[model samples]
Target: MGDTFSSLLELGGPVVLILLVISIAALAVILAKVFQFASARVGRHGLVRQAVTQWRTGERNTAAQNLIKDRSLSAALVRNAMDAIQMLDQQPLSSQERDIREERLREEISARAADRLFALASWLKALDLVTQIAPLLGLFGTVLGMIDTFQTLQESGAAANPATLAGGIWVALLTTACGLAVAIPVSVAVTWFETRLEKERAALEVLLTGVFTAGSSSTVAST
Candidate 1:
């Protein structure tokens, strides 16, 4: 292990360090996501269950308080829904006004969902940047090795055999291989993380949809 790392350091220290940093960042992201989405604990916890409970009972304030108590990515969406429902329930309204209120609530819900999406996009962009640059840096190492090999050839004249210059070419080959290895996995990880996020978002949507429809149906039946 030590010898391999030493070879990498000597051949392309900057590229190796950059890839190391990216790998750390990617690892952190994956761990965070695993914790956040695995058991529905991080984002769901007490608030989401309470939101569903409140919807069943038509108690918007209970849902709002539950939402306000927590600050996960899902909280904003629940809070938006609670506030919109409360606003519509309290307002002096003709039927036209009620329709307007419902439309406004839909818009607010979508707006809240939009808020945390930028963070996801930023994470994906960082991974993509690393994926793009790793191969190029590896290619740079290969080019530098070729330059060193040619320089040695000039100094040694016809005396140097191809076997003598193999070390430099080997470094070039290894760097390119390492770069590709780093890039391919990082790109795949980015895709996998995005898929995880998509599933979580879908869950959130389903939770909200069921609660909203149940709440509205119960309200109408009571009226």
Candidate 2:
């Protein structure tokens, strides 16, 4: 395998080498993102929903406790909202003041959520760049190789051999193949990561909305 890879690098030249480096970097990023998503439990929303339900039913402490060990973005934001509302309840404020404070708290939590999502999205742009440029790099390599091959053939004049020309063409095409190989998988990974991010964003909005609405209803009922 090592020999085969070395031979490919020789044939593909610098373009292939650059692609190899990019593929390694892209793989590292993908692995790190996978670990991050797993540790943060990105799509695991059952616990978050249960906590929100607890909060909605006026079990503030229970809701907070349910999320004590949870590290998902949704859970964290919901917890923040719960804490803010609980603190607001303890404050001696007029109705207007309370409403203003609650609005500010909501905005703060939303901003924090946006920051978390942005963190989750970090390094994704690098992956996107790889997907976009890998193919072009490969094409660039092929074009360069083809130009060299034709120049050699022109030099050979009447002695130019068909077998040699065929060999050169294949060698010239290798870079394009390698470029597509790197790009196709990276594109798939980018799509998957983006889709998950979108889902998480939607989930965060829904969970936070649930917390605020539930608190308002409970307050209304009590008054």
Q: Top TM-score: which candidate number?
A: 2
Residues 35-74 of candidate 1 have per-residue lDDT tens digits of: 5454333335456766767666666556677777677666
lDDT of 1 at 113: 67
Error of 1 at 62 (Å): 8.2
Extract clashing residue pairs from model 2. none
Error of 2 at 191 (Å): 0.9
lDDT against the true structure, per candidate, is 0.69, 0.91
- Point out where model 1 deviates above 4 Å: 1-4, 13-72, 211-219
By summed lDDT, the worst window of 10 consecutive residues in model 2 runs over 214-223
Cα displacement (Å) at residue 151, model 2 = 0.8
Clashing pairs in 1: none
